[model samples]
Target: MHDHGSLPALGWSEFLTTWSLQPGWLLAVVILGAGYLTLRNAAGPASTVKGWRVASFLTGLGLMYVVVASAINGYAMALAWMHMVLHLTLIMVVPALLVLGHPLTVIAETGPRAERAMRSLPVTILVHPATGTLLYSLVIIGTHLSGFMDSMAQSTPLMVGEQVAYVVSGFLFLTGTIGEEKVRPDLPYLGRIALLVVGMVPDTIVGIVMLQTERDLYPVYSGARPEWALDAVRDIQTAGGLMWAGGDGGMMLLAIGLVIAVVSSPERRTKMTGRFLDGVRSARLAEESARGTTEGPAEPGSVDPDSDEALDAYNAMLARMNQQH
Candidate 1:
């Protein structure tokens, strides 16, 4: 085990030496890369899978590997702060990148059968905004409970399961909110902003509670003492602080990005304008109908017969009637 206090001086060579292989992570990367390539090729002459999207997907895969198989993973088992870093990257950073890459869209575009699967009712519900938000919140809150955290840290299999939960929850949260792909219950720009803001509340509460707690929550780290004389309590506090700040900061950035995307997209702007106009028209029609009910409609041809305006109107009406006939 490495000393926590010596974390700063842990050179790249030393970090590389400590790197571990996670077969699951490796397999995921291979599958993701192959899927992207296959989707691109299968998309016919005009591929929707852009170069940047491929890069983004690969980058997400790299981040997952770093959190699971790099030296960071080894240190995370020993240090509370490192563990927090790993969790944040897995849940916040990696998910955002992967969602932006539009993985579901790529899969759907793979073939007719894949498209049908993507459109299934179960998949639709899984990606619904409400379902995703609830599941994400449950995973975050449930896993962070003192007993659960301690149990997970003690068992390697449990830790792996916890990591999987984090990735899945994070992916679900972002799949319908941030990405360009259209999922079930597609939210408007304002709705997406509201969803993000609401989601931040639980994360903020968890962070604050962890930071304020006096006693250590996870006892698994007591045996993994650092040679550099690290203070476990202080490290735990730091981890809580990171969780609080990182979670809120990441969500805020995503919200801003969503706002920018809405503003920049001509199609979105047009749809918003159309909705606004429809609303205005509806309100005006309602007002006119109410007025008509309260009073009464004007008698047909009620204009003054002697006035030039009435004569012009009559002539125009006659022209229109003749043309229709």
Candidate 2:
């Protein structure tokens, strides 16, 4: 095990000042940040992409740097709760911000070839919401529930690998569910909301298991824990609680964001209303066609196909559903 014998007790001042200069991670961030800006600028006046996307993307990159290359990394190795904080930030908050950036949409705008490639079979499958959810579930459950944590603490490469996996899995999941990439099929807002809500289940499960487990789950922490670190059991419980709160809380916030986006977008609301009206019209036409085919002709007493009664009833049903009447 790497030495934590000389590690200082975590405090606000130290947390603020202590940072690991991981040149490799920093270089990656700089490159990605530069690339995103270049693409955003390249899209130019023709693009409708907003300014906030650029900000969100950069902010996400910054947070990723802090999580992996800051004092958090040091504390995380010796403290379970700190690790949970690092994990949740990497997997949840950072990914959500990046998704909001719409990087894929920006890339697709480069040319027809790029757009087509984005919509290619392999890319489509990789970004599918189901695939993302499955990978996310596996990562969360595998890393926390199994012996991966024990191994990760001792192996630098494994630690880096785990961090990379968290970001990738999260990015894939969010990119599929909440992303509005122009090259991909638009996921209905309601469907996006549902996916986010369901995704919280794995976090809840892992958190509860960690919080309630009777025995120490990760011996590695106990062995490497600094003098000031919480005892293993208490530390794990705290970590569990943090995971449960952070995971569900982050998902809920994102769901609410989707709800706000739907409510705020007049085009989306209009589209939904058009769909409802179209469904009603289709049903009416089918009913008329069926009556004509079966009875051969309409009787004098038959309801008029153009009558407003059906539309009125539908409106009333909607009002009732909304508790408006």
Top candidate when judged by lDDT against the true structure: 2
Compute the lDDT for candidate 2. 0.82
**Candidate 2 per-residue C-alpha lDDT over 1-325 given as tens digits, one digit per residue, 9 for 90 to 100:** 6667578888999898988888888998999999988888888887656899889999999999988888888778888898998899899889988988988888887778988988899999999889999999999999999999988878989989999899999999998777888777766676778889888999999999999977889987568888787888999999999999899999998888877877898656433334446466556544544442556533332433245754554555566669963
State the C-alpha lDDT per candidate. 0.74, 0.82
> What TM-score goes with each of the models?
0.79, 0.86
| TM-score, cand. 1 | 0.79
Across 1-325, the per-residue lDDT of candidate 1 in tens digits comes to 2234445334578667777788888998889778777786787766576878878887998889877898777777667777888888999899988887888878788777987888899998888888879988888778765577767756778888888888889999988678667434456667778889978987787788778867777656545646553466776778888889998888999999987887898666443334455455444443433342556643433433334644554566577679999
Local error of candidate 2 at residue 163 (angstroms): 0.8
Question: Which runs in model 2 stand beyond 4 Å of their true positions?
Answer: 270-313, 316-325
Best candidate per TM-score, number?
Answer: 2
